[model samples]
Target: MTTTVAEELRRRELERYILEMEWEEQIRTRQAEKHFKLVEDVFRQHLGEAERMTIRQLITGAAANGRCEAMVYSFPARCCTDGGRAIEKNLPHWQKTLQGNAKELYHVFTETAKPQRYGLRAAVVDFAEGFPAEIGFFVTWEPLFFRSDESIY
Candidate 1:
C-alpha cells in the first residue's frame, strides 16, 4: 500500500501526542507520590512509636469489638471510650479546666471502610501551650447509638 505524505504526517503527530500525554501522566504521578510521602513523614514525626502503636490498637479494637463505637482522647488526660454527647459548657469554663487559654476549636470527620461503614468525627480543641482536647466519635447508620447530641464545634 502506498502511503500519502499527509497520512504519514498525521500518524507521526498522533504518536507524538500520545507520548506527550503519557509523559504528563508520569510527571503527575511522581508529584503526587512525593507530596504523599512528605505528608506521611510529617504525620509520623508528630506521633512517636508508642503513640502510633496505641492509636493503631484503638482503631483495631474498635473494628474488632462490635459493641465498641468510638474512642475519645483528651490531651494531657487519659483516653476514654465513652464518646457520648459532650457536656456543653461555657468557653470560659473550658479554658479554666484546660489549665490554658483556648486557641482554636475544630471538628473534623472522615469516612472510612476499614473499621466499618462509618465516619470518624473528631472534635479538636487546641489550647495555648498545652495539649489539645480531642474526641473521636464514630458515626454509623444507627443515629440513636453513635449520634452526638452536642453540635460539632
Candidate 2:
C-alpha cells in the first residue's frame, strides 16, 4: 500500500519514556537518573489529584482519546517528515512558533505546575555497518495525566 506522509512517519517511530542523552551519560550517568526523575516527578508532583477525575474524563473523550494533538506536541521533529521537512530545516522559526502557541504543549511535555512526561532523545545507529547514523525520539503515554494514555510516538 502506498503510504501517505503520515503513514511514512509510522516507519520512523513511537513511544513515551526512555533515557535519551549522550552515550557518555547512558546507563550509569546523571542524565539517566534525571530522565527517571522526570518520569517520577510527572506521576508524583504533577498528576493533579483534584482535577484528576476531570482530566481523566477529557482523556477518555472520544476526540481526546484518538486525537493527533499529541503528535504535534511531542515530536517537534515531525519536521523531518516530507511534509514537515521544511519546518525542520527552519527550526529557529519552528521553535519561535512553538514558543508561542505551543507553550501549552511545552507545559504538557516540558513544564508547568506539572508537565507531560516526555523529552527528546537521539540514537546513533548504523543504517549500514560502519556508517554513523543517529535516530532519536520516543512518544509515550504518561500515566493518567489530564489525558488518557492513548498516545502515539
After the best TM-score superposition of candidate 2, give how far the Cα of residue 16 lies from its true spot, in angstroms. Answer: 38
Q: Which ranges in model 1 have alpha carbons more than 4 Å from their true place?
A: 45-153
Instruction: For candidate 2, write residues 37-145 as lDDT tens digits.
Output: 4444443454555534433333233123333112212333332333233343445433333333233334554553234434432222223343323222223333322
| Model 1 agreement with the true structure over 7-117: per-residue lDDT tens digits | 999999999999866655554444334333422332354446774455445544443343334442344322322211231222322322322211121121221222333
**Global lDDT of each model?**
0.38, 0.35
TM-score for each candidate, following the candidate numbering = 0.32, 0.26
lDDT agreement of model 1 with the native: 0.38
Off by over 4 Å in 2: 1-30, 42-83, 96-104, 109-153
How many residue pairs clash (N, CA or C atoms closer than 3 angstroms) in each of the candidate models, in the order given?
0, 7
How many angstroms is residue 97 displaced in model 2 relative to the true structure, after the best TM-score fit? Answer: 5.0
For lDDT, the strongest prediction is 1
